[model samples]
Target: MEHPSNGLSIIGCLRPAFYDEESYLRGLFHNEDGDGYASDWKDGERLNFNSQSAGANICSTLYKLEIMRMELFSVYGVQSSISLQHFQDAEPDVLVHSSSEIIERFNEKGMKSNAALKSLCRKKGLNVEGANIIGVDSLGMDVRVFSGAESQTLRFSFKSRVTSGRAAEKKIQQMLFPRIQRKKFKAHDEGLKNLDSF
Candidate 1:
């Protein structure tokens, strides 16, 4: 039953745009007279998880999204508030999930779609069998290749979160010293001219 994997079938690429960052922030925190703030978030906490507090904050954020049904599958690349129950060609498909056989079929179809999606996923050593890395993003990557070049695109979400690093003062010193040297040379030239008058 392995048919071709349609790139559009991978689904849900643009739904995050639906998220209201300001509202989300407020929902996380629920402030009184000011802005929304998540409970227990300390100042200077890392945005991505590396420490215990950072990890806890991320978990809190995910918990909130889950409560909002924001983690479900997409319908035609748009986020579905309900599970895959009411798609075209198959309003009945949604009604069928209660049956164990239908549920298994649904699950199998999903797994197959995921397997097709793995055609797009990549890490350091893992490479797509017949694809080219065309783009990268915060959460995932994209590749260009399919049996039909026009078919089967993939967006591979990262297994680990990326964190940003701040520049250290020592590194800044290395960059500025050369500029300082040029300025000092011009000052020395002025000083030599002044010494000529003595």
Candidate 2:
């Protein structure tokens, strides 16, 4: 669902209990006549899909969320480290806007040979041929890997939290080109030391 105030899109499955109810009650937040629980939600639209495909998509989304939750727990020692308010209030547009560029750069950097991807493939014992970054956020990204007749979703965490898409892009660049990033970091450090001498 898209936030009424900010336009950040969040996708998740509605509970089965609300499946047969009106869209607004099912958390759609909008309806005809501009009068509903979320009257301010003006442009909410629902798309119907086959049960099988929808179920698969929901499963994939849930899996990704689970992985993210685990990562958060490991990092923050609490499941609710990031509250709902964070998502509601945070500016995700920058990250959303730069996702395509990040994906392109990742693919262009020879995704199949990425050490992280290779590690996942080896750990899972799967022969993945091609991989694509399907989604990215401040914390991490979800990558879709394709084998001969199977596919898998893998999660890669960022070294540090990024607020903007450009920052996320830089993080991915650092991951893909560690040597270049290290050299840049070294040069930056030298410059800082030179300034300290002044």
Candidate 3:
């Protein structure tokens, strides 16, 4: 069993309660052996790793410590592939390929943020490729990223209020809900040279 208060190794998405192949990658990177482990065939004939808490395990602490929190209230909203901007100066013209515009924009801008956001994102290792800053609203800012691929997003909510410094880490940890760790398989030895240790 993992010690209490340790963070997750498996990456999880709250909007879509699911785990994919990438979870394994998260497992290998965390604990070398403690958290990641292979199970017997009876245990679903698969390796085993830890699971994330269903929801925020330390929300109270977060609220108290993080003066402001950027909760991703919603995400991954997709629209129809067709857009009027893509067509020529007339109607029913060739539909524009969504990806073409993304490439074009990247050419104009380096696909990076200004000095401020860039510094913050770098501290968090954010991938801001193919992003567009539309406008600012009550939600701080309206932005989009990754025109076609697995378009990821980021929302920053900063209230002037003050919170406990200690709580900030846990708040971000649970919200991000980072990737989990996995263990390796114990294969049979090629030779029977040593039963002596046993």
Best by lDDT: 2
Model 3 lDDT tens row, 45-115:
23333433454222110011211212222343332232224322444212123223432343354423333
The candidate with the higher lDDT, 2 or 3, is 2
Instruction: In model 2, state the lDDT of residue 195.
Output: 100
Error of 3 at 138 (Å): 3.0
Off by over 4 Å in 3: 1-118, 161-198
- CA lDDT, every model vs. true structure: 0.37, 0.54, 0.33
Q: Tens digits of per-residue lDDT for model 1 on 93-196?
A: 22222233322332354544333333324433444444533333333434444353343445545454323111221221222233666487679989999999
What would the per-residue lDDT of candidate 2 be over residues 30-120, giving only the tens digit for each residue? 3444432222222233223222332353211111121122113322123334455565576745577777777777767674436545555
Worst 10 residues of 2 by lDDT: 58-67
> Whole-model lDDT for model 2 versus the true structure?
0.54
Which one is best on TM-score?
Answer: 2
